[model samples]
Target chain A: MKYLEDIGSYFLMLRRTFSGFTKADVLRELIFKEINDLVMSSLGIVSFIGFFVGGVITLQTALNLTDPIIPKELIAYATRQSIILEFAPTFISIIMAGKVGSFITSSIGSMRVTEQIDALEVMGINSLNYLVFPKVIALLTYPFLIAIAMFLGIFGGLIAGVYGGFISLDEFIRGLQEDFIPFHLVYAFVKTYVFAFILATVPAWHGYYMKGGALEVGKASTKSFVWTSVLIILANYIITQLLLS
Target chain B: MIEVENLKMRFGSEEILKGISTVFEQGKTNLIIGQSGSGKSVMLKCLIGLLKPEAGIISYHNKPTQEMNLNQQRMLREEIGMLFQGGALFDSMTIEENIMFPLRMFSNQSRSEMLLRVNEVLSRVNLDGVNTKFPAEISGGMQKRVSIARAIVNNPKYLFCDEPNSGLDPKTATVIDNLIQRITHENNITTIVVTHDMNSVMEIGERINFLKNGLLVWNGTQEDIFKTKNEDVTDFVYSSNLFKKIRDVQNS
Candidate 1:
């Protein structure tokens, strides 16, 4: 029953977020700020994680395939496939579910605790639209960030493959181009876009409705991360089943 | 003027406001005073439309709140200003931006015009030349002043303050009380303040409503506070040694 209530409340919050739009100027400023906070600020950590994880994938693939019959180019092929299909999109989103999700929850939850949200409402502002809509719009840049992660991941794989003696540079390049499917990129982006919406709204729900003081803000952040990750994983499974399987 | 009739509020099984009704006059510092858990805050919230009463009529300028259409509700809310107990200033914004917020949202004033009005209110609150400072950089009293500045920046017709003196020193609290009183008188705005501070009650409580356990036990003015023989009002008002001494001196 509690789960059902949360689900119902989540949908209600979404409805409120979509209705009673703020002025375009205010929304534009908020969106710009969110883009800077959610997308731009996240670049360093995402790139670092993408590069190291891609390199690890390459080394593992190279070590596992000990048979000479298996061409060395297969190392790059495996790395590229893993990074594009799952690592860059799904894993990076999970990481963001921790980083950005906690941030959204804590910030909004603090506002709730401090009566800032109430203040907004008391002033005739649609608090949900004012607070959450910008976040959702800013996260439209999520696919773009994932694209950067994809580039760096493959680049990291190339460097690791050549330097770690996993495969020659030319061979790795050939493998990257060997079985490239246009649809795979499309599939990844579709999932990225879906995950992006989940990222913005799920954490917002936890924070906006949270009760209590500072300690409750921390607790809401943790709960937001858990629920966001769970929803993302579930959505990933459902999307993969519908689009790829 | 604001009038509340038979206002009742509850939290699940717990009743917070038990059909309390009172009138807060225009151009006066109307006060709601009670001990903690006496439903003073709950009554204030209900009056402000932040919490809907389970039963009652809250009429602003003779228009019932529940009967107002969406646009009317918006317009009504715009005409109302609130000062929270904790100041509730947006931490991310500087004092100037905080003061300019309501104008930016609801007015057609240009940037220069908004800044002028913001400056006027800042000066009105006696908080000049700290516009660039964030809420955290200022003292609690200054933050309360900023909150008041923001509340009145749009020139609201009604003002509600919840424990406006909660964290300030006695001296600063008196200053805030006087400031609120002056603002109310100057604008002829209907102001309602919820507080338990005897200093605030004695200083600017032009009309005072005393609540005890969700019921309004006494209604009178500052002069009447001393002359009235209401037991609850006497007990609550003279609970402190300082006020008791003052009361004794007055009698003597």
Candidate 2:
């Protein structure tokens, strides 16, 4: 019953966050700051993680195709599909659920603890819109990050496949081009957009309504990460079922 | 002036404020003092609209708060300022930015004008030329002053402070108390402070309201406090041995 009530409150918070928007000038400033904090700051980790994970997937695929009947080009095909379909959009979002999600939760949770939200309210500002809406707007840049992740992941796989002698560079390029469907990219981006919204809002709900002191702020951050990751995985299954099936 | 009538607030099954009615006069330092868990802070929160009373009318300048429309409520809030217990300065902003926040949100003034107002308030609080310094870089007392500066930079019609001197030393607390009182007088704003500090109660408590277990047990001036036969007020106010000695010496 408590869990159901919390879920209800979370939706209500989101409703309030979308309405009673802050002034355009203040919102513009907030959105810029959030973009800097949430997206620009996460680029390095995303790129590095994307590259290594892509390389590992390619190596594993090559090793597993031990039968002579299996074409070497299949290694590149597997790497491309894994990186584009799942690794970039889904895995990177989970990583951000840990990194960026915790940041959103802890920062807003601290503000709650310190009464800054109350100050905003006392000043007649919509605290939810002022705090959370900017984050939602700024995360519109999230798919761009996923695009970079896709590029880096495929690039890393190319390096591993060609140089490690798993497949020739020409065959790998051909393999990447073979049976490619543009709809897959569309599906990945659709999933990315949904995950981005979750990434912005779920942590915000946890942080904004959190009570108690510093210890509770830390606890809310952990809970936010857990919930965000759970939702992302769940959403991934749902999206894939709807889009692919 | 701010008037609260028959205010009541509760959390679940436990009632925190039980029918508190009081008036905080303009140009005076109104102190709400009581022991811990006596609903002093709860009353202040209700007055500031941070917490909604289960029953009551909170009026500012003859207008009931509940009757105000959204725009009216925003206008009323714009005319009010608050200094939280921990100063509550935005940690990410510098002193200047913190002071300029409300102004930026409400006023159409240019950046230079906002900066000018911020600096003027900073100077009024006896904190000059520390615009770029963050809240963490300053002392707690200075942070409180910065909060005061922020609270008044918009020239509010009312000011609220929650335990303005809680974490400060004796001397610093007195400085804070004096600063708040002076600012209240200078602006002719209705200022309400929630605290249990006896020093604050005696120094700047022009009008004092004493609460005990969610009820307003006593209300009077500081002079009235020293002479009153009210057992609850005396017990809480003279709880310290030093205050008791002073009271005894005065009686003798």
Candidate 3:
């Protein structure tokens, strides 16, 4: 009975957090800056990882497609699918989980343990609305920035292929243009939204329920990163199957 | 004014608060005093909605807390200011920012107006020139003062201090106690303080509630406390040699 009640309260709190996300003032003040930072601040690391992975996947896919049964155009197709649907959203959210998710959890968890949340509540401020909503809203919107990173990553692959003399710029461009599908892009963007939600919610929930002193705040931060990363990967695969099949 | 009626709180099998009840009148410093494990803090938490009680109701005025919705509960909470035991100021923010936090969160005050209010509260707590200093640069007593400034910045109707003097030196503790008393009187707010310190009980115990094993054992004014015949209350109060000597000298 107690466990059921706890679950019920958790859902209620989650609903409260979501409703808070819908407020225009909160979005304007808090979430906008967070989205800008999550997208802009992480650009360097995402670009660095994106370029290297893009090069490797391109090399491997090109070498395998040398068989007469497979068309050389298939390499570009596979790269497009991987970069948009998987690499852009999943890997970027994983990196974000390390950076932004950990920050939210630690800050909120410490506030919880230290009675800052209590202070807010006593002041008639909705602690959940004030603390959690902006974060969720920012995270929900930040993935569009990662979609841009996907373009850059694929561009890096084309550059690497041209530099290595595996494929000419004109050939790569032609392959990409011919292989692109509108539905794939839509599917990829939708996947990013889900990844962002998992990344934001898991960490926020962990931080919200935190108890004890500084040690517990540390624990919540570490757990937020670990669980968010795991959930992102698992979610990526499930979404892939659901979308494709 | 606040009234807790037959409040019971439990953590699993451990009953941290058992059938505790008391009233804290407005415009006075009301104290809840007990040993460390005697459930004083738990009762405070229960009153403030940090912890939910398994039984009984806490009322602000005559409105039962259990009857209020989340927003109404939040409204009641907003009418409160709390000085945490650890002086839990936000580390990333400076003293000015820390003091300005509640005003920013709960009030529609503009930046300049918020700064003016922050300065006023900081001056009230004697933290005039150190507005930009981080919490690390301040002493424990100063941190408590900053916490006090933050608490009062919103001009709350109820002020809760959880061990407001816990780690301060004697002089600092007195400063915090005096500050709380002064703030209570000035604002005419119902202030409830939870502590184990006899100094606090004597200094600001306009009304004191004694809790023994999670029960309200006695409630009275400081003068009434000195005249009480209850052994438990006397044993708790006169346990210190300084208090014992004072009691002996007074009797003589």
Candidate 4:
């Protein structure tokens, strides 16, 4: 029953988050600020994780293919498929559910705790729009970040497959171009956009409706991370089934 | 002027405000004084349009708040300023940015003009040259002053403060109280303060409403507060001996 109520409140929060606009000038400034905080600050870690994880996937794939009958090119192909189809979009998002999600929850939750949200409402600003809409618009660039992650993941795989002596550089390049489907990129980005919205809004709901003091803000951030990861994984399953099958 | 007529509010089978009706007039420091759990904060929240009452009327200059649409409510809220008990400054923004927040959100003033107004209010609050500092960088008393600066920056018609001096020294608390009262008179703003501090009550209680357990038990000026013989009145008086000393001095 509580879960059902939370879902209901989530939709209501979504509706309000996009309901009306505040001053465009203020929103523009807020949007840029959010972009810096949410997107730009996240690039370094996303790139690092995407690169290292891709390298590990390549090494693991090469080590498992002990059967000399298997061609070395399949390692590169498997790495490409893993990076683009799942790691870049879904895995990175789950990571962000911890990083960006906690940030949003704590920031907004602290505002709620300290009555800054109430101050905004008293000042006649739509607090949700003023707070969450900028985040939504800012995370519109989430897919762009995912695109960078995809590129970095593949490059890391290339470096690992060749220098680690798992496969020749030429074979890795050839496998990357092997029967590559354009729709998979489309499919990946479609999921990224959906995940981006989930990333921005779910944490916002937790933060905006949260009650209590500073301790509750920390608890709310943890709750936001848990819920965002759960929802993202759930979404990944649903999207993959609908699109891939 | 703000008028509350038979205002009733409740939360989950328990009524927090049991039919409160009163008037808070312009150019006076109207105080709502009660002990903890007396619904003082809830009443302030209601007055600021943050919470809607379950019944009765909250009318601003004869326009009922319940009747206002979203646009109308926004318009009304734009004219209202509030100071939370904790000084609720935006942690991320500097003091200047905090005070300029309302102007940036509501007005289309140029940057220099906004800065000028920000400096004007900061200086009025006696917080000069602290614009670049964040809320965490300031003392509690200065934070309350900055809260006041932010509240009156836009020249709001109604100013509501929830315990303006919760954690300050008595000297600083009196400074804040006097500042609020003076602003009330200078701007002729309809100011309502919710507090339990007898010092606040005695210092700026131009028109005071003494609430007890969700009910209005006594209403009078600060002078009248000492004169009343009612048990509820004397009960609150005995709770704080400042008035007793004044009463003794007067009798002598």
Candidate 5:
């Protein structure tokens, strides 16, 4: 019953958050600015880390496939499978959880501790919609942005792999074409969407309930990152097994 | 008019407010005065619906707050304005944006209309030409004035001020107190101000309710405050050294 109630409340918060997209809403600037700074701008660093991790996986696959039982072409195939199916979405979520989760937690927690949230409520404004909803909507939207990030990350790895002679450009291109199934893309989408929701919601929930002062805000921020990261990795493993198996 | 009936609030094991019932008339500064931890602020919060009273009924005019639906609660909330102790201005927004916020949220006014209303409230608060200033850029007194402007911009029916004179110099405190009284009278709104400052009590205590240990011990006008024979009230009223010296001179 509590879970159902929470979902109902979540939808209400979502409606209010989206309703605030007007040019005049107090949170429009905050939501858009956070999306740009925390999601779009972090793309380069995420792509960099994703690219090398992809390369290392490809190299390892190449070394493993040298036995007579496997074809060298399968090395590129497995690399595509890993990146598209699990690696890109899961790793990028962890990165964003560190970035956006901590940001939401600290910002909202400090607002609560400072009585700014209470002030908003007193002003006949819905503080939860003003504060939490933006970040949650941004979280749901930014994962698709991170999906684009994953594609770019994989593209970077493909370029570096061809340059380093780990695989030919033709083989890399062929591997992506051959191994990229519809379910791989679906898995990527599912993982990222769920991760994004978790990353945004956990921090905001903790932050919203935070008390005391600056020290407690700091603690909420730290706890948000820790709990969100744990939940992401755990959820990643569960979702992958459930979806793929 | 605002009426609170048998309002009670408990925070875990501590009973913060104990059956606070009072009526604040329209167009008067209804002051809640008490020392720290005397539940004055808690009573104010309960009246404003910031804290749910464990037992009691608060009515705006004749509508009981507990019976109002969410939309009704929101409507009642829109009719109310609050000036927080710290001003509570959105730190990220400019003064213009802050003042325009409620209009944009609740009113269907056009951009030009909102801007006009915003400018009118700004001028009313004597905050002309500071529209672009951030909350952080303003002085404490100026922040209080801006908060006043924001509170009144909505043309609220009830104004709740929690410590408008707090953390200000005596001169600034007087200015804020005077501003609140002037705004209250101009709008004919029932203004409920919670404070421990006797200076404010003397300046605008048109109707004063004194709380001690979460009970409304004294309810009277400022004239009644000084003229009363109540020892507790006299001890609290004349305890200041300045008032003591004045008393000595008058007696001599």
Candidate 6:
């Protein structure tokens, strides 16, 4: 019953947040700041994780192909499939469920604790639209992040495969092109956009409706991370089943 | 002026405000005083339209608040300025940005015009050259003054303050009380301040409503408060040795 209530409240909050925006000029500035905080700052960690994890997946696939008939090209194919289909979209988002998710929760949750939100309401400002909408717009750049992750992940796999003598550069490149489905890119980014909305709204719901003090802000951050990750993973499964099957 | 008629509010299982009806007069520093948990804050929230009451009529200039649509309510709120108990300054913003926030959100003033207005209110609050500083960089007293500056920067027709003097030294608290009184008189705005501090009552309480357990037990001026025979008001007013001695001296 409580979970159902939370879900209902979450939709209501979304309606208010997206209904009518306030002060477009000021909101433009806020959107830029959010882009810097939420998207730009995340680039470094995402790149590093994407690159290294791609290499690790390549190495694991190479070692597993002990049968002689299984072409070395199978390695490049497998690594490409893993990174594009799963790692870039799903894995990186779960990472951000901790990084960006907690950030959204704590910043807004701290505002709730100090009565800043109440101050906004008393001033006739739509606190949800003013605070959360900018984040939602800023995260429209999220698909860009996954695009970079997709490239870096495949590139890292190439480096690892050729350097480790698992496959020649030509063979690996050919393997990457072998039976490559054009729609997989579409499927991956579709999941990213959905995950992006989930990332912005869920943590904000926890922060905006949260009740308590500083300790509760911390608790809300933890809850946001858990719930955001759960929702993202669930969304990943749902999107894949619909788009692929 | 603001009027409340039979205002009532409740949480899940408990009522916080029990049919409170009172008038906060225009151009006066009206105060609601009560013990903690006596619904002082609840009453203030209700008056500001932050918390909708279960049963009551809140009227501004004879317009019932419950009848106002969202746009109408927002227009009403635009005329209001509030000073929260904690100052509620935006942590990420500088004092200048914080004060200019309402202007930027609701007005078409150029940045230069807004900056000039911000400086004017800062001077009114006796804060000079602190615009570049953040909330965390200032003292609690300065922060409260900045809050006052923000509240009045737009020249609101109504002002509400929740515990304006809490978490301050007595001397600083007195300064805040005087500042609020001066601003109230200068703008002739309807102002409601909620506090339990006796000093605030004595310093600037032009109209006082004394509540005990969500009920208005007494209503009078500061002078009338000292002379009232109501037991609840008497017990609350004279609970301190200093006020008790002052009352005894008055009697003699």
Chain B of candidate 5 vs. true chain B, TM: 0.97
Better of 2 and 6 by lDDT: 6
lDDT of 2 by residue, B62-163 (tens): 899999998998899999989999999999999999999999999999999999999899999899979999999999999999999999999999999999
lDDT of 2 at B90: 96
DockQ order, best first, reads 6, 2, 1, 4, 5, 3
Better of 5 and 6 by DockQ: 6
User: Could you tell which candidate, 2 or 3, scores higher by TM-score?
Assistant: 2
Clashing pairs in 4: none
Judged by DockQ cut-offs, is candidate 1 incorrect, acceptable, medium or high? high
lDDT of 3 by residue, B42-61 (tens): 89888888778999989999
Model 3 Cα lDDT, one tens digit per residue, A3-106 = 57756876787888866332355447767766665556767777788888887778888886777766566666677677877787787788879987888788
What tens digits encode model 4's per-residue C-alpha lDDT throughout A1-245?
99999999999888888887888888899999999999999999999998988888899999999999988889888989999999999999999999999999999998998888988888888899999999999999999889988889889988988999889999999888887999999999999999999999999999999999899999999999999999998999999999999
Candidate 5 lDDT at A97 equals: 76
Query: Candidate 3 DockQ category?
Result: acceptable
Ranking by lDDT: 6, 1, 2, 4, 3, 5
B246 Cα displacement, candidate 4 (Å): 5.5
Off by over 4 Å in 3: A1-10, A20-27, A63-74, B69-72, B244-252
Candidate 4, residue B175: how far the Cα is off, in Å:
0.6
lDDT of 2: 0.93
Question: Could you tell me the C-alpha RMSD of candidate 3 in Å?
Answer: 2.8
Report the lDDT tens digits of candidate 1 across residue range B36-66. 9999988888887788889999999899999
Q: Model 1: how far is B245 from its true place, Å? A: 1.4
Q: Output the better candidate (2/5) by DockQ.
A: 2
DockQ category of candidate 6: high
User: Can you write out model 1's per-residue Cα lDDT over A6-78, one digit (the tens) per residue?
Assistant: 9999999999999999988989999999999999999999999988888889988988999999998899889
Task: Estimate the lDDT of model 3.
Answer: 0.83
Best by DockQ: 6
